[model samples]
Target: MTTVAHTPPSGTRHTVADDIAGVCEAARTHRAYGEEHSTLHPQVWEALRSSPLPRAALPKHCGGLEWGAPHIVEAVRVVAAADPSAGWAAAIHAPAGAFLARLDPPLAKELCPPSETAVAAPVIGGSSVPAGTTAPAGDRMRLQGRWPLVTSAPQLTLAALAARTEEGTRWWLVPGTELRVEDDWDAVGLRGSASHSVSCDTLVPAGHSVCLTDPARIDGALYRFPLYGLMAACIAAVAEATAERALEAFAALAQTARPRHATGSLAHLPAAQEHYAAASARLSAASAFMREAAGQAWHDAVRGQVENAARARLRAAGAHLAATSAEVCQSVFEAAGAAGLYRSSPLEGCWRDAAVASRHALVAAHGRRLAGAQMLTGSAGGHL
Candidate 1:
């Protein structure tokens, strides 16, 4: 089910359409295997690096699509719908596109050579947070830190990390040769994310590093994209997919579902009908909003029409819509009742995956509120 990225149009013409469709189809294969592919199947991780979605959303200047968050919004939803773990993989791919591309052109060139594959697992390891950096040497940063909860740390070739200093905030690009992976990404749902701990004690060459919060203003719109927005949109998108699967399953159940001591089938029940209908409506709404919002942001970013304020608005909207969509999709599971509780049904997986995925720190109660609060306070969402 793996495929290459479609050739992009001269500007932002028509390539994203085909690229998104392909990401949707490819993620399904990973979804089919779910967590089994994590420790058991290294091939799944390998496929992800070579997959189109990661490359599709990359920075255009650095051999990437430069689609901004909109690109992520479309693809992540499809991937999450198939597998939450895979969705996370794609979510961070934007970092590869955004931060990685911002490195000195030659550094970017060295980090990911033309014929070689590169992996990045970021851990901000200051106390419990993945927030520390290696001391800067003459040309290379002398790496000496360990970041836990790094996804794919076990296999990553590079580490994208942020560290605070006396002067300002900084980020760097370190090689896997400088890292040590510690198996720590053990979770209930996205266990396959390969999110673990990593230790580094090597030098990150000057050409391969950049201070994301440096004096220079980097113009990659994807860097301006919101983590919460990207994460939420992906969940919302998956919810839409799950809703579709649930509806189809519910429809079949409607024709044949029968309960004891009941006069007619579950579908005949007014309550069941209402709940299913509502769930379906929510699913459709979420998908539509996701598409519209994502498309608008990406298109605007490419055209230089969206500034930080506009981008924040889009991020806030994406987070809210994603949160609402998750809620709506959960209703479908409720409507499905005990029969829809089949262990193997896609509905069940959708419920668990969406619930756990939505619970990401970015979309949590506080983070969601913060986004709204930022908008009201005239503050940009987090950092630019």
Candidate 2:
């Protein structure tokens, strides 16, 4: 499952897809192991480590590819099509580099040194919720709190946690070793994400904290892109790709699967054909909408004028994609009949993954409501 490093030559254009092309097969081959063990397979993890996806969103100076939102979403889709859990982990960890840009240049560079190895793009995991508290401790800060749903916790090199301080809610960059990881992620779907809870009660350098309200030190459109919109789009991309894979699995199953009490294969049934057609069309439309929305936001960000309207559109599209993808997966599952109910069935896994992904707060009803409020009243009264 090991893949040769595919770092492009200087002055040559390379894509996230090209960088991760070799890992897709490994992802497919080890998906079951991850699902069974509740963590990414070691081979797949090694392949990913060799790839540049972990630092795709980082600035070039920071030893990253600095990919745009649309590109990142496409990469996530590609990986998810191979394995939904892998895709979920990629989506969760890929954009973390942006958080590092909030720190001062020296500290940011020190934490993410320029290297020709995976250490340059360390795997990061944390929650945005202010579930912890921080206090001034002379020359340092004492941070204490428990954050849940820390994806890729077991492999994180650095953690980006949010805690409330006297100033306000700020993000802290604590070494993974300082946190106590609790292996408690037992979700039915995305079982391999390793999204366990992490708690920290250690003193960190005073310079480790960053107030998101402050302007970003890095100068780039990728850094300017709306954080919430980017996260929502990434999650939606996973759901969309998972649904697409489910449809493909159902199509393969229909070719040889015979319906009970029927003389012909499942593909011969008009109902099954209709369901497949409808699901495929819906998924295609949803995927297109998601790309368009993310692209528009990125364009605005590049121009240094990301309007609230653009953010609203992206958020709304993300929510729509999540809902549509879940529906499409369910439709494909139903069309597969009892054949899709087995635990080994890929369609069943897609259905479960989509169901769980749709429940994510970023792409939930609340986001859609906020988007609608902004579009109608010109004021969301909250972050879009």
Candidate 3:
């Protein structure tokens, strides 16, 4: 099997921003192809794989920068500002190695040898029931089940499957080839995310399965906070990026759009100015709120403190930002008038991306409710 490679083909210093810009520049010309193929262009994928963008949150020993949630969120925002699909992919795939960092030493060594770079795709939402029947076969178990919404499934080297069994829920690390892609991720936005259904009927070694340990037990600062809270913040960052793009696109168009009765451009029109200012204010407020929430979460994590209520509050802030960003995107699109309706316009894509991203379960209505209930009861609300 081919191992995940980390060496960049070019000899140069590359930061997260540089990697994001490269992908954006490449993807900007391939939006039509991405829409048609339902995946990022091959060049864009290659650029992503060759960069250090994937292991941003893993421990230093595991080849990550060991940065906290805020850095990851910022990187995601920069990427999504240019290409929403690539931004979403970065948000999902970058911190994946952190999951393995929580594994036992022996298992972690066997699966992610220090000499190898590993790419793991987390299957977020799927049936809790056993995906496929499992039978003991020598040192391994034969398992079969279908999982959905496996982000970046095509580029993965390993799959982290949360399988339900009579014993309880267990984590299964299966090889990417062992799973078959169903090619059914036909979403209206984030088309290049490679979110597809995967069915597996293969032998997974017993050593590859383990009961998930509590994040608090992990020694890394990245695991100090609740996982969902960090994830929600990153998701909110993407929405913020979408809003920023929409607002910029609208501002550019407004400088030239002239109404029939107006002697000047839309920028001089009272209604247009009001719409632009309102949307800009909304985006700024939401962005500031998300950053503040993420900053608090990171500071607490670095101090090795687990403040559940604060984490819940962060999730709430994230949801609010997501919703607010969506509103900003819609407002900017409306401000674009007929131009926004065209598929060729960036406003249309930004609006679509915001609509889909804001609805992610982490930032959806339920997440807000969970945060609210937790705040009201002074509880952690682990359900999130």
User: Highest lDDT: which candidate?
Assistant: 2
Pairs of colliding residues, candidate 3: 131-145, 132-144
Candidate 3, residues 229-348, lDDT tens digits: the string is 777777887888888888888888878777677799878888888999988887787777776777777778889775777777788888999999889988878877786787766788
Off by over 4 Å in 3: 1-21, 116-142, 166-170, 207-213
lDDT of candidate 2?
0.83
Model 2: how far residue 70 lies from native, Å: 1.8
Candidate 2 worst ten-residue window by lDDT: 1-10
Candidate 2 clashing pairs?
none
lDDT of 3 at 115: 35
lDDT per residue for candidate 1 within 1-384, as digits (tens), equals: 011134445554454436445444555655556566454144556556655655554444445555556555556655655556666666555435555555655556566554323232221111124466667798776756677667666656657765565556555677666677776666665566677777767776755545543322346556544434554555555545444665776777766667666698988988888888777777666556556666666666566544555545555555555566567557767776777678665566656655655665555564456656666775744442
Instruction: Judging by lDDT, tell me the better candidate of 2 and 3.
Output: 2
lDDT of 2 by residue, 195-250 (tens): 99999999988898776545568888987888778888889988988888888899
Clash pairs detected, candidate 1: 58-66, 107-207, 124-130, 124-131, 125-130, 125-131, 151-195, 152-194
Least accurate stretch of 10 residues (summed lDDT) in model 3? 119-128
* Model 2: per-residue Cα lDDT at residue 176: 86
Per-model RMSD to reference: 4.9, 3.4, 5.4
Residue 70 CA error for candidate 3 (Å)? Answer: 1.3
| TM-score for each model | 0.78, 0.92, 0.86
